[model samples]
Target: MKVDIMKKRRTVLNGKPFSIVDDLTKMDLTERKKWAPQVKQLYDSGTRLRFSGGKWRDSAGKSYIFVFNLTLDKKGGVQKTNFNALDACLSYLDKFSLDDVWRTRNPLSSGFTWTSNIDNIRCRLDFFLISKKLVNKVNDCYFQPPLQSDHHIVILHCDISIEPRGPGYWKFNNSLLLDPAYIDLVNSLISNYSSDPHNSNQNPASFWEGLKFTIRNNTIRFSKLKANDSHIYEKNLIKKIAQLESDSISDENLLRELKDARSNLHLLYKNKLEGIMIRSKARWVEEGEQNSKYFLSLEKRNK
Candidate 1:
């Protein structure tokens, strides 16, 4: 029979929920009577984040996510034989390496779990730990009996967060899309400026270079220019401008990576790009009011 939570009676002591309130309150690890039965509850938290081994809470209240897959046909009997949860957890880590992104503390890092489900088949879980004792339930799944199908039918019910990572970022103005006439005007300006070097102490190509180079230096400049001919949209716009500037950063991939530095607009911020995004004068501090906003999304920083 599956473990049923609905039918159980919970004992709450001193405003905390525990596996066994009486057992947890009086924990004596050396004593067999106290230690043997509730051994799982007696964890010695180490250094900094004591519960760092598993998932932890996110800035938001939502739990971080962990995911992995497993192939368990080699493990013999299904019903009679008992499977180890620790082995399952290890197997999950092997399949999906969550540790790689966890250190960055991006939205992706979290821990995974595997437990037998109420259904006839074994199940896998992608959970985020909220605390040493609390965790967020994200992906709940179960497998079907290995009937005619080559593999078990696994049904996944997931609650994943897709945020600023989703598409549609702010766009630049279309006037920067250079054309033949604009190029001709730039060449015309170059001819005029270069021809009168004796009369004018200004740089020879200053006029043409100013139009071509300034567009990249300032996004606000792109908003003001008037397009005359070629109207480049995405990559084409970047390519055309780069060709004119000689040293232009028109690559979409590179552009996305430098979003935080280029603009305060980022999918998320990193420490290096933090204060650099700020662009100018503050109207002095206000008293008795909080200046920063904190959004709480729950997440686990492990697995």
Candidate 2:
């Protein structure tokens, strides 16, 4: 059974949601009481979980995530039947609502999880799952044996700080030139500048500089007229939402208004993304397309 961890409580292959527990195979393994605490500690220590043997895709088309299970015998050895061990791990994850955080490549640099006894099958049995909130806080994780226990110790280097970023300048929307009013304003500025005798005898460099200054001021003025009001409106809506949240008693209508405002804000952001993608062509080009011969052909044609 497939599972969509983000939406459905049970597994779903794709978008559809369904629930049916599959058959289970009974096998001998250690109880959960012994190593649950240790597992939880590592899980909480910002260590991402990963599967050593197979590739499993998640709802986001991601193959690996922070999937982990621990069903070791009293002697700290994997059960004879590995299936039982795997089942235990899945059940534990469901019980705790834990998700995997596996990146594209394996994060382990060097580590020997279990010493091979027969055919030199040294498996990396020791795995961990890092909390998403603490993923950024972790700097590094690796195995270092012989510190205290015979089992390899997973060392994590974490140096995290909370700092506020300064407010950046807003981006200008060049597409505003499509508006007839904007075109007319540009034409009026150009005509007025041309008619001024002060600019008639100016040197080539000075004429270019004056033209640039006039265009810049005109753009800024139009931007303030069109964009600034919308920005202020969004900010005010945010402030209203915050005020409502802080209040001891919030009216239903006020809450609805806030939700509507947030929805509108989201729509505006969606439109902005679409506009940016349209203007900034090739920014989101697919892999292998960047260095393709097709780009060279286009450059030649343009020239």
Number of the top-ranking candidate, with lDDT as the measure: 2
Cα RMSD to the true fold for all candidates = 20.5, 20.0
Query: Residue 255: error of model 2 in Å?
Result: 4.8
Residue 282, model 1, lDDT? 32
lDDT of each residue in 138-226, candidate 2, tens digit only: 56654433212324444555454435677544455678778898889888988888788999689879987998789778888887887
Q: Which candidate is the best by TM-score?
A: 2
Candidate 2 steric clashes? 8
Single out the weakest 10-residue window by summed lDDT for candidate 2. 20-29
TM-score for candidate 1, please give it: 0.19
What's each prediction's clash count? 20, 8
